[model samples]
Target: MKLLLFDFDGTLADTLPICIASFQEAFLQVDGVEWSEEEIEDILGPPETEILRTYTKHGDPEEAVECFYETYASLHPKVTADPAILEMLSALREAGFFLGIITGKARRGLDYSLRQLNMEGVVDWTIAGDETERAKPDPECVDRALQQFRTSKEETMILGDTDADIGAGQNAGITACAVNWLPGFTPKPLTLTPDAVFRSPEELRFWLYRQENPLDG
Candidate 1:
């Protein structure tokens, strides 16, 4: 079966605001530091430790990580998916595709969001940043999903909204698509250009089915 590997934050759900707020809360509560919006957005896609380090002049990385989780967990469900995203995902699942997540979010954070969105059943697997030895931009999670389904990268596609997602797909040797969910919000392309760029899920839907059935493509 063709595998569709998705990135959680910024892709499936709109958790960027809560994530930035949680990190800032951690920084303020733990170290009396505050980050500008630009700073927060700049560090959103990397590991939690990296985001913490960027906000700190001198502080314990472990402490910041703990605080981040604590604050984020308390703020779960504050953000949600686009109205049609879950339906689109369901259609893809029923279309004979294996659906999974590869995200920089922690397991607890990802789980909470998935549960609130009532999507735990549709997703087959999720590899959180802390769940594996390596995270996105490294592609180990994507490869892991490929292995789980006994499929090859040739039969896989990674859809995400950031550069790290593109890097992960490149690392795994799979086709990648850069999804621009927020129109007029321009960010630099991932270091690698994706096979396609889509502005909406409907656009991605057509592209995915085409990729899934190459003869029909």
Candidate 2:
């Protein structure tokens, strides 16, 4: 593929732990409620602001959002991207592939993670959850990226860690690839199977290399 779109949280970086911790802390601080990791994952498709607005009971949603950001930033240093993922991204970029991110995170959170993980300037474009009228499983974000990159669906692929990411890619008529490299991640049953499923970053890198260099394979 000439253009690659990646999902951020569980795919590019191992930020799910910190994300869960941040949400739990935000809710506990704001609403005096302790949310389980499953509870947080159940409501993960939308932006954190929307989640806080919809789920916070005893406090102002805006305040909860702020608290979430504060907690997230505090916990961010504990998470880091796998070196192999960084290597794969760099290789793809150097090979003339346009790399982008299509994430359920808001722009602020995405930017923060990029900076913390030392991934700034790695992606050519990004479409955050709040940037689109609808979240994943809707094609709006993917469509926008395709438009911006001027790449056809046949020349692009979307790699992610969850079914929503696959659905988004499918809805946008692009190849959908799934990776389950992050430990302890158990995604719900996919409504549609992905075009390919990879077990690790290295596996994915090799697969993409084959796709790009069929003669080498």
Candidate 3:
């Protein structure tokens, strides 16, 4: 079976804005440093500490990390899965592709998004930043997802919208599919070199199906 590992926030759902709002709220409660909309959008998807370390330089890193989660917790429940994404996920699963979630978000956030879309059992496994010893840009989590799905690297594909996510996939020797849904939202203009890049679920479908069935034969 082919494994199809997905990144939760940008690839599967539109949780970036909610996550940014959550992080900002987390900071506001602590130093009231006032994270701007641009700042919030810029800081999406990386491990929480990276953002805390980079942006919360005004405060103690330890305290800022704690505050970061507190604020994110406050807003996570309100986040919803983008419907187009959910439909694509459903179709992919139905087609017998082994599916998994590999994300920087914690288990609580993953569960919330799955529950929001009634997809608790849709994916074979999930590995969150909080659930792993190392996060994205590292192959550990991606390896775990492949182990859970029992798929080989060649048969598995990793999808996300960031360079870090691509790094993780590359580290694990999985095919990287970079979704261009929100690359501009990151801190830097993340110029990614994915094995494949798609703009929407429909585009993804065409891409995957074409790859899986290339000939008129």
Q: Which ten residues in a row have the lowest lDDT in candidate 1?
A: 182-191
What is each predicted model's overall lDDT from 0 to 1?
0.78, 0.88, 0.75
The C-alpha stretches of model 3 lying farther than 4 A from their native spots are 37-79, 181-188
What tens-digit string does per-residue lDDT give for candidate 3 at 1-217?
Answer: 3888888777776667777776776677666678887877655655666666667656676687777666655666665556777778789888988788889886766776677657688787788777788778889888888778777888888888878889899989889888865433442345767898777778887887887888944
How well is each residue in 1-217 modelled by candidate 1, as lDDT tens digits?
3888888777787766678888888888778878776778777765676667666667776788788888777776566557677788888888888999988876777787788767787777788877778767888888889889998878898999887899889888889888877433444556677889888879988876665578982
Of the candidates shown, which would achieve the greatest TM-score relative to the real structure?
A: 2
Cα TM-score of candidate 1 = 0.85
Greater-lDDT candidate between 1 and 3? 1
TM-score of each: 0.85, 0.93, 0.80
lDDT computed for candidate 2 = 0.88
Please give the lDDT score at residue 52 for candidate 3.
69
Give the Å error, residue 35, model 2.
1.6
- Tell me the deviation in Å of residue 167 in model 3: 1.0
Candidate 2 deviation (Cα RMSD): 1.7
